[model samples]
Target: MTTYSRRAPRTLLLALSAAAVASTLSAVPAATAATAVPTLTWEPCASTGGPTDQECAELPVPLDYRYPGGRQLTLAVSRLRSDRPEARRGTLLVIAGGPGSSGVQRLTQKAAALRKEMKGAYDIVSLDPRGVGGSTTASCGLDEGDRDLVTLRSWPAPDGGIADNLARSRRVADACARNGGAVLRSFTTANEVRDIDRFRQALGEEKLSAWGISYGTYVGAVYAQKFPRHTDRWVLDSSGDPDPSRVARGWLANMSAGADSRFPDFAAWAADPAREDAGLRLARRPEDVRAVVLGLAAELDRRPKASDRPGRPLTGNRLRQALQGALYSDSAFPQVARLIQQAQDPAATPVLTPDIAGALSDQVAAVTMGVVCNDVRWPAAPASSYARAVAADRVRYPLTAGMPVNVTPCAFWKGAPVEKPTRITGRGPSNILMVQSLRDPSTPYFGALRMREALGDRARLVTVEHGGHGVYLGNGNACGDREVTRFLTTGVRPGRDTYCAD
Candidate 1:
């Protein structure tokens, strides 16, 4: 579920020595060298289609680095081998976005595109981060209402109150503490990085080149920082701020600017005459589209519309939630605009997408909450501060309604981070290339600039002047895609920051 915003597994600790791993490493061979390949056992696993090529394998890793022979958890792994073995350069790991997102499914969805682009240049691989889809799981067993996206995201009240948010955050935090097990306790970025190294060892790659997107960019950056020598060619797409101190908290907060940056694109699309016949045109002018949306949201706040569904009328929060969803992609903008048009017209009926304001699985919410909670501490006064922020944000960027800076369970998250969050310094190998959209609704240009500054001489940034979450292969921009493709294939990056005009 890619919301306008923003998984915890076991805290498996591994102290990876770059030289030692490179010398005769257990997981991967040294960079620029080939070694004996370790055997990988592939077996069927879980997905929408019952018996796909999905496979499961275990990577034995120390539970605690201090106690090397301690207990271990089997990390579920999946792979899609390249079609052309002769052209295969190496294994390119697809690091999933959410700390809670499934890497296996991502591999399946993007395999064709990756294979087509690279042309048997690499075997695509991914793993379910602990406590995520198909991985070893944990549960908070939250009630249905608490798991709803509107409630879970801690959106301010229609009337601008946050009392419900305060109560919900505390209640959800308590539920997780009581019901979530040790596996839930282990969900942290440091542990995920450790598990990745162990998986690298299990795969028998000397150095792992990776394509990390969204939240995965942070994970990739940490991996690069922790094990600089283990990297081959790293690609971070639609990246967020890499301020390790705030981690996921900062990423969540960044949605404010992200949505602001992206909404104009949607506005222009909704205002286009091309959308008139589609019944998706919200207004005649681009600015009018924004006004109509905000006005409708405000009107819904005052008097919610009765929908085809029984009690689920289009409410203010519902409209806001829809806006959040629409900002993700161009394809979705029309649907959201249609939702608005239907709500405005009494005779018309709007088809509500189940995802707009539904309850995510208790498990999904838990993992989403756990990772942010466990990674870093947020101020407990989020509700109070958020109310103020939302009011200010509504004035500053009315498109998002200040939900981006609002509160969440992290404010009341029970667990403390096990290890220090990795600050992505420029001290690593200079082999990293970042491809970012200038107007990404989720990871805005401001945050990406922070990452660019942090990476210093280690990275070359290719800025795609587009409007979307992902730049490469997402927005219809040849310049951005070519820059990334060239870098991934030939190991050549732009001499400096380059712009790709849409």
Candidate 2:
């Protein structure tokens, strides 16, 4: 499905400094702090619409770890046992990205490929984090109108305004405050890290290896730091900076640079000869592609064209948002180009894909916004701050416009964090491996480098001179996949950081 998790924090724990994160590891509350988590009972999970070899189980943990004897959260976990028993040494946890992504589904989709690659050195396993997938669920009961991707992402309005976004921030914050309960509040990265350890305990493994992508990389880092001795080899793919000060807000704002870094690849592809026949070509030359896209966006802003949906025409910001998503992969370029070509026709109606065309479910919208807002305390600076930031960002990075810096629901969130966020550090074992795309549209190369710097001597990074959001197995970049697999199976890392040519 090419499922990408748009990845999130709080107060027992509020701001995580490197030293705090290091010291907290020694105090990670035991599995039986007050109530012991239940033993998992694995059963064939084929009926859940996943891979056949997958076994599923429910691992119960405290809904609020601080109150161990309170209500419980049943996380849905799955695993594909190693086929080569003699080579099996431990469990390889697949930490799927997204504050709302499903880890079981991720393991299902990649189980066959992962098993084939490492030749069964470990049992591949994953769990849907709290408030995600089959785990305990919660919703803000948001209106359908607020679930649109462009709106959800806080894309600035025409004229580079964020008034609408600010209002939306207030509206979403109100909805969550009114409806999102403890379950929603519990959707923080630190809790997910705690849950991973509970899963490890259920499996009876001494040390677990891990592969976390995007937001999952943050989860993996926290898990490694909080439970250093419990970790084996760990690989972080397409990571963003684990800046405890900003957390999700920092990652969201980083999209400006990330989109800028990746748009050229799409522009080059859009200008290809093959696109001419499809009437999807944007320009005769790559340089002109930007102007064409920007011009089209402005035109749409001036006069929104009729779309397939009644009374809901295609807006400029929506088109821009679609373009940003399309730039994530080369395969999606055609869809964005087709939309642009259709919009160019005054009489033609543009058809929106499911991802952009309609509103997501209330639960989806709530969780997506909830996790990020709950991760850390967003600045309550005056409206002028966001307005200025959006205006400046639009000028600096036209591809993303001002959406990256625009106000989000976090700005008006009512719930204060229960704990501080965890800071990634070089204090743990030097067993972490990071793989990054040189031209990633989402996480971007530069942010990943910042993460590399933060990890310092604790990690080795594999740089892929490629354009995409994910690496290892999915990108067909054999170099990235090889390095990650080697580290996972053989525990052998490059002596120093290295790069892999496209």
TM-score of each: 0.89, 0.92
Per-residue error (Å), model 2, residue 15: 29
Across 1-502, the per-residue lDDT of candidate 1 in tens digits comes to: 1111001111211223333334332444245232222245777665564325556665554444333344555566787666786677777888988767888778767766777788767777888887888777788989988987878888788766778887888899999999997777777777788778767766655578899988898889889988887788899998888887787778777887888778889889988999888787888899888779888899989998877676677788888888887787787777788789898997986677566545788778888888888887777774557788878876787666767777777787776666667788999789999999988888888999999899999998999888888776767789988988888788899999889888
* Candidate 2 C-alpha lDDT tens digits along 170-197: 9989989889888888888888887887
**Clash counts for all predictions:** 10, 11
Model 1 CA lDDT for position 56: 66
- In the predicted model 1, the residue pairs found to clash are 7-99, 7-100, 8-187, 9-186, 9-187, 10-186, 11-186, 27-201, 29-206, 89-121
In terms of lDDT, model 2 sits at 0.82
Could you tell me how far off, in angstroms, the CA of residue 36 lies in candidate 2 after the best superposition?
2.3
